[model samples]
Target: MAHVVSAMASETSPEDLTDLSLEQLLNLEVISASRLGQKSSQAPTSVSILTANDIRTFGWRTLAEALNSMRGLFTSNDRNYSYLGIRGFMRGGDYNSRILLMIDGQRMNENIYDGGYIAQEFMLDMDLVERIEYIPGSGSSIYGANAFLGMINVVTKQGKAIDGSQLAGEIGTFDTYKGRVSYGKTLKNGTDLLFSASHYDTAGVENLYFPGYDSPETNNGIAHKMDDERADRLFGKIKFEELTLSGGYVDRGRHVPTAAFDGIFNDPLFFTDDKQFFSNLKYEKALNENTSLLLKGFYQGYDYYGDQAYIVNDARVINHDEASGRWWGGEAQLTTHPFEGHRLIAGLEYQYDQRQRLLNYDLDPYLPYLESHRNGHRVEVYLQDDIQLLDDLVFSAGARLDYHHMLKNLQLNPRVGLIWSPLTNTQFKLLYSSTFRAPNAWERDYNAFGFVDNPLMREEQIKSYEAIAEWRSDSNLRLLGTLFYNDISQLLEGHLTGDADGNYALINAGRFHAYGGELEAEKRWSNGRLLKASYTYSLLTNENRHGAWANASPQNLFKLHYAEPLFDNYLSLGLESIFIDSRKNGLGGKVNGYELVNINLSSDKLIHGLDTSFGIYNVFDSHYQMLGVSENIDVLRMNGREFRLKFQLTF
Candidate 1:
């Protein structure tokens, strides 16, 4: 499968791009890199793209699975939630707050936690995605906040892409099952509409063993039927001419088996439920060949509920936790060519957080521990210009000024990039950028029995520098290499204070530094053959602390992906392999690293109006462990081999 669509045109729709030639796909335009439609090679930062074709061929079940195949990116799951790791910067307990996630240019991060959901909790089903654009490095100059490391943009398929009604069903190992129904079409009056709904359920691992709870009373370190998960999602979109409306909703529930947060082991009462919803309205128009205008508004809401069973005074007690968040925002952007050699982009953005609520208490006794409600707003303005300094050189510069209500302060972020293309097929870039992440409400105002609030916490800041080189051949072969350095300050870390209560608080810790390098190569053949490989090396450390900051970040990562047509175009096969170096866990113990291989066989032409696929994940059944997020849990064992069979019918 071809991972990147080089045939994408600047203003063309996804359905139109499919009809273009391979050469056009090689120059595919990316929007997440600079909020503008520009070729990936010409973008201000390093970018990677994946299309729906790749997802179908690889049998990717979730967004995280698709993203994990990219260079310098990985994900870990504790059987409850998934976390994203980028270039050795993933920290234990962090809720993926540093990376920004957008769906069709609408921010999806909630107001309270600022977390990007990538697992089953994600709003859109994988089948609904048209393409995903990943831009690495500091992106605050264009995006206000939560773009500390990188950003992701998910583009949904248009109604015309589906062109009809569809039904899909899947059955996987461990009693997992899923079903989806969708309808889409383009009306004769130029109106486009699409709607989809899906439901998923999994019994999960039957006998999950936790070494920390080995007593007989705790099921001898084994948890039975405690890792179950269920999710439901709905998405809809409509478009007419230049105006578009879209919305999505997801509700997910997962059972915990690790006894996290001091929960009772082998108890079925430990579970978390998450729900998110968003609606977006957008308008776009081209004033002329050299000018374009865009305006958008969005509303988002999030809710979380959790129950943890604990032993209080030798009796079983249940603790209830809940949070609710709601927010609305708007943006106006203009892109124009001020002169022959310059392209300028300017935008204004505003957001109002209407509600931020957190509640925690004990059941049965009706004892309250914490209750808080707060609201805030933010405003930002940014400008970026790309100038053709010379025939073979391009200079890009941008900056943003933001006013945050919580901080009561103004922040300025800047970015610069210089690209030199000495040869038509070769280019080199030097880039520098700075970004920040504001402390969320959960980290600032949630004071509870086991946690304390820090209202005066400072925002985390980072500066990144990168040098990149890329080369592409006419035969659809590409090679890329990059070296990067990141310096971070005032990082927020949850630590136990010296107080007698043993309460944990979020504090602005000392500085951290990371340096890394990445190398990648990809080649594609016209006969449905592709090969891609990437390697990453990183060294991360804390300047103020002596111990290793190896939360979940690995030092070395290697990935490979291959796809080929089989049986004279009747079937397609995909193979993927990944290797991660060993890393130290949160408890100062080393977690052994392991490799994983996955295979998938798929075909869309085997039957009329039907698509079939079979996938085997973790083919080797490597017993790996990922760092745990809770203080009571040191490491969480990962899943073994699993199989899935799926079929889709279109009418």
Candidate 2:
């Protein structure tokens, strides 16, 4: 298989891209995740690339909005709380512990609770984002522990990418307002610096269906007051040849209304403030004509106050508390091509996390509070061979071995891929990979209301197989289809032990299977018009557990996007449609699914130094839910028909 793929790849020649638009850059190869410059189709897993043009066309305000349109990805809203589940397994807000987020190869997910706060929007200013590369599968082989669910790598804009300083702002319904300013400069010594700041505020829309309260004296009630939110953020980056450094800070505060309250209800307040700093240094020395040695190192720090809630029940009850923590880690990697068609990558990583709870209502009143801390060290080595057997086929295989100090366990992940190009414009690929997820801090030490910690938890593992076919016609039509199956073992399920205090401890249990398929097609017209569409269907079943079939796994997900030039290259119109099938919530109850439509009209013409845009989201005001957890406030309310008009000027 490897020989066939290598031969086919060598037979084909690269294309000339002088006429391709910026939007077409989505098809370019992604280099961040794999540390290898490989196209998404060649990867052994599901990968999605969102280009800068796509971001602008969609008018996405945050990373969440951009991800919502992707196939196989799901999102749910719960006021200041948000949840993301990929493939099938999903939990509510504070999911950073399971999924991993990286910025320019630096880990950003907080270590506490096994996750970071996803609802704290505005963590990354959209204006500064150059592009986003997403891989929806286990990344533990390369990223270590938190790469359980998948990886989202945010690629920021460099000073070289921007022409000069720019400023922009927007105002819309529900008292929503946003503003941003950025500057970029290049030094004489081939170095560059870029800085940006943005702010967003909103008086949230009314999402509740039922109006006022009913009393013994009357059955009539008034409409519930809608919750509101406000946020601010700052980001900066500097680049010097092979070395890049970046940092940012974000502060977000929001207030959410209770389900049963009008003016006399509970109002939960959430505040999250986080800081991120990281640097990447790389050096390359040529060993010979066909061999070279490359070295790289990265360090990152993330600190935040996550989901601190002040709960007021009825009139006499007052519950106030907060959870805070910090996570810091560093990685060093070395790569060498000692032989022709052979590549070797080796890395070592170390991470330490400390969590402190200042106040806990459930802890023993007399016992002294103990600050919980967890430190982890991981060392790994991996090697791969991309053999070029013939002019039309390519074969690649690799394996990774990692040692974890906390788990006292060693993991081995292996992957193999074969690419065969029978035709100049068509490719067929087969891939198989094994990956695993280490138990997070929360899964091991969480002892809260009705949830007990399990110290002897085992890591979860998955073996996946995938096949893909892609055809790119010379007439500007592209079609792609993929089929995949995953066998998962060591799934962690909570073991319930009913105690006097109604607390339940979690014990690892169960094995599962997940299978899915995706199809996508794109067409580009000669007149600068294009259409993109995709569909995904998946089934996730817990083979060991009875009556556990009705969870948040959608049977069908579909999307359609259209873009056309309205007036030469100065004006354009964009439309998008997203559809999701009905699925069950965490409690095994059915939830309705709906379709959403959005439209945007924008231009690249600069008036003075300003670039301008006008757009509308939820054009039809369709009501829908992104995600649903058990008994949690259902995030069913959709953003109403809203208009966002903005102008960005560059100096």
Per TM-score, the best of the predicted structures is 1
User: How do the residues 390-434 of candidate 1 rate in per-residue lDDT, one tens digit apiece?
Assistant: 998999888888887767578898898898999988889888888
RMSD of each: 2.7, 5.1
The lowest-lDDT stretch of 10 consecutive residues in candidate 2 is 1-10
Which ranges in model 1 have alpha carbons more than 4 Å from their true place?
1-7, 10-13, 16-23, 32-37, 139-141, 546-549, 629-632
Candidate 2's C-alpha runs over 4 A off are 1-27, 32-37, 94-96, 116-122, 138-142, 206-226, 258-265, 268-299, 303-317, 354-359, 362-371, 525-527, 546-548, 606-608, 626-635
Cα lDDT, all candidates: 0.83, 0.61
What would the per-residue lDDT of candidate 2 be over residues 442-501, giving only the tens digit for each residue?
A: 567666546767778877777777788887776778788888777777867776677677
Query: What TM-score does candidate 2 get on C-alpha atoms?
Result: 0.86
